[model samples]
Target: MTDTTGAGGPQDHESDGPTGPVIRDKRRIDPETGQVRDVSAEQVQETAAEQVAGGDNAFGGGVGDALPGGEQDPSGAPQATSGTPVDGGRSADDLHPDTVVAADRLEDLRRLQAEYVNYKRRVDRDRVRDREAGTTTVVEALLPVLDDLHMAKEHGELTEGPLLAIADKLETTLGRFGVERLGAVGETFDPAVHEALMHLPEADLPEGATETTIVQVMQPGFKVGDRVVRAARVAVADPA
Candidate 1:
């Protein structure tokens, strides 16, 4: 065999064979700067990660020093605040949407509560008035019977046993219900409580007689509490 391989001659190497398609770098380059300005996807991703890592320190130093209030840290970043913001730098008008909604609902509830209280008070007052009105009506209807009893007593019919006792008991029961008799002879006449059926001139007036005095009580009046149920029919004596 002929020994053609010699030292310093063309070295035996692997043959260049057909392989997979090569990737092309088609990044845009600035014509003015001859430097490779285009960055790889890996480099861009790394830069983005760095920016994100330093994001928390953005307000730490330069911008923080320029701000008015609060303390700063050694790294030029603003120090962590001890407490939360009171109103989150918002005024009453600039409150959060959820906060405003909650406040509005609370106000509505308070208004409804007030309205309910007023309604309840009105209902209670009306109930009391209705009860008084019903009682007054019944008492008024029974006035004729009372008048008959008064007439019988004046004629000495109710002077004795059962009838007098029954009248007394009825009067006591009515008194318990706040019913009261009004108007008496020799009392001061009042337009509010008494109705003058006739006027008389006083020649010799009694003690405490005034310009308007009740000389005679023709019919007694009835009242319950401060409410007058019936006016007294009376004769008034005018001082002559």
Candidate 2:
């Protein structure tokens, strides 16, 4: 071997090899820009990595800046903040306040309406009960006079003297109050208003048919309005 050492590490010779040209690890020049590119690709990669790390440190890194209500970074990205954003030109809390108030008012109105209806119904029922009680009191007060009249009629003394006049006057007074007699003789007997004291069989009437004529009026009955204050006690005749 001949001495081949040159200035920069090694010198290239034509008889060095027949395979290919030898390339040296050294600085190169770009003919296009006429500037020297002294950096290797690995050095450029390391410098780019350092720049990325520095940028991440400045921006607080990752998804922290992108969160709502977060502090903003210098790169125009949103940062975390203590307060939340207002949406739709209003605060998030303010959006449902009116709806909540309206719902409460509606509930209050419904309760009031229900209470009013119940109060009306209660008042109506109480009024009806009070009227019935008053009518019952009036009818009860007239019972003694009716008993006297019935006793006089049964003794056949209803047609003479002041007793007849007194009974007529009492009946007239009761009639003004809607008091009517029930189960009179020769009238069809109704079980709703008449009580049969004795039932006798008579073959002159139709078979299985009931003779409802009041044969004897044992007690007088009275009604006020549509309600029977007293049921008539009578003897029903059955034709044989």
- lDDT of every model, 2 decimals: 0.74, 0.72
RMSD of 2: 13.7
- In candidate 1, how many Å is residue 124 off? 2.1
TM-scores for every predicted model = 0.55, 0.46
Candidate 2 Cα outliers beyond 4 Å, as residue runs? 1-99, 150-180, 200-211, 224-227
State the lDDT of candidate 1 residue by residue for 160-226, as single tens digits: 9998999999888888777888888777788999999998774345776656888776778998777
All candidates: CA RMSD (Å): 17.9, 13.7
**lDDT by residue for model 2 (165-187), tens:** 98899788778766788877765
Clashes of 1: 5
Scanning candidate 1 in windows of ten residues, the lowest lDDT window is 1-10
Clashes of each: 5, 13
Q: Lowest summed lDDT over 10 consecutive residues: which window, candidate 2? A: 1-10
TM-score of 2: 0.46
